[model samples]
Target: MKLKTALLASVLTSAAFAAQAQEVNVMSWGGSYAKSQVEAYHKPFTAEFGIKVNSIDADNPATPIKAQVEAGNVSVDVADVEFSDAVRLCDEGLLEPIDQSMLPAAPDGTPAADDFIEGALQDCAVANIVWSTVVSYNSKNVSGTPTTIADFFDTAKFPGKRGLRKSAKATLEMALMGDGVPAGEVYDMLDTDEGVDRAFAVLDRIKGDIVWWEAGAQPPQLLADGEVVMSTAYNGRIFNAAVAENQPLVVMWDGQILDFDLFVIPKGAPNLENAKKFIAFSTGTKPLADQASWISYGPARKSSGALVGLYSDGKTQMAPHMPTAAANLENALVNNFEFWVDKDAELNERFNAWLAN
Candidate 1:
């Protein structure tokens, strides 16, 4: 019942249950869902080690982490950062390199190092969570469930209340796809103003019907309340609602954004050694697979990618929450972390202005 500080070193100390009690600090996103999933990652981890887990969380974790590293008093040994935020911090030299040798072997003994999906893992950060914004439609109310982004925004066909995520990048990418852009061309098209405007123009046409959900889980909530017959929602939450509640909600993986969040070691973290141990352990098969069951977020570990205990049926797994559906995985537009990392302020400002207007 007592909430002990869950910090970075929590993973290694949690493992082995050895006599040496070391304290490590971890920084991560917090909410009941996020907190519970993160804490679950620590459970099997702590069982093997003798260290104590101290987890520190925040609403928006980037700026505080930057300050901590800049001040040269890095108490955060391991940090769970958003995909975009990780890129920004890495550019500022606040993140440390991940040493692959420390990681445990992949199940079945295939090497995990560099075996991850192409471009999914990076130098300073490794994939921790794989998520997607998917098309979800109420099966009970709507005659035919929508399966594509274009179908989600199609008013005449699937007419009802609709919702779209409020974020700039994911929305832009989805809009482009809705406008008929191919998955491969999404990044190239987004590199130009015309392409960007074209995507927004599609949204402008449906802005009135859209609920504009800012939080990831909002789509699923809206669907349940009947506020939206259909909307773009997080894959996990949508899948959970659909399978657990057997709601008529369904998803189309035709065009989705499979965004991955990562764990980065702050440059001056209080305990770099323990942090690495935690990361390696977290990305290991067991914890990664465990979080998948509790939360819909897919594990980053390539070895763990083969559909764990989340759900068995293909129909259920393809809901807006699960990223493992072959069709959806192929259609996903991975976020361009390099571009956004350097252009965060300018792009985000422009994005806000665009949204306001």
Candidate 2:
């Protein structure tokens, strides 16, 4: 009787441990982006490993990650963050370091280090997608086609309210580009006081016409509802609205700001090992390519490019729609994370002051 009781107690304890080990919490930017990750990464991961994934959303995952880590109550096992935030958070020691060797090799047996695109792997982050912030307009509302970046600033030509993100980062870059600063020269120009003034001066032209959006989901809704005719938006949101929901939206590739979204483990994640496993499985070549089918964002791995084909709708080809496509690259600007990492606080202070005035 004593031996049977001990055996029952041990079985119950082991079952509890197994149940606890089979779940992970992932935080990400909400809206269509989150949906894409759920479809491509989460569903497959859960099926393959028999682990439960809890999907959490925020306007920006970075904010909650910082808050949680600093408060010493980290709940998120993994988070999808922008390149600058990843670098900044890693530098501040708020994230766990990810070794490159843990990532899976390509299908052809090429190592992960060689398969990933340049700058995709970092000390504490592994990139999943290369997304872009582009200018998009509701076709039914706009007067004529606004092809160039400068057209976005010219109210006289477009003649409707513009939706601009309520942040200093992309807003300033687009303003400089609208004022005719070339893509390659944008960062160098923004590095100066005079250049900063120039960008703000251009923004002042359309200040009254601007409708500010802080979340990725807002831009598409703003355009669809005619709240704003033209908006600077994440390309994937625009694509989803246009293709999936059958909205009359058009993306202007010119002046698009390309950047990467990476997955990182918080400093003290409750399921650290499971988080690492999720990252490895999700970032593999097939999974990366699978994400592109759900959204127009390019895969971070070079090996995944060839595998990216039609969209989920079964007809739309994805390559030409990608931000990295040759045609789209004509006047595109790759985001300078280093510049933003150093200048984000100072510029945002000035931007807030300007907003008040």
Highest TM-score among the candidates is held by which one? Answer: 2
lDDT per residue as tens, model 1, 76-177: 787777788887788778899887666777778866676565655777887777887777787777767666778866888887888876667677888889
Q: What is the TM-score of each candidate against the true structure?
A: 0.80, 0.98
In model 1, which regions exceed 4 Å deviation? 1-21, 29-36, 54-60, 67-75, 141-144, 245-247, 306-322, 342-344
The backbone clash count of each candidate, in order, is 27, 0
lDDT of 2 by residue, 1-357 (tens): 999999999999999998988999999998888998999999999999999999999999999999999999999999999999999999999999999999999999999999998999999999999999999999999999999999999999889999999999999999999999999999999999999999999999999999999999999999999999999999999999999999999999999999999999999999999999999999999999999999999999999999999999999999999999999999999999999899999999999999999
User: After aligning candidate 1 to the native by TM-score, how far in Å is the CA of 126 from where it should be?
Assistant: 1.8
What are the candidates' C-alpha RMSDs? Answer: 6.9, 1.2
Where is the poorest 10-residue window by lDDT in model 2? 28-37
* Model 2 lDDT, full chain set: 0.96
**TM-score for model 1?**
0.80
What's model 2's lDDT at 323? 95
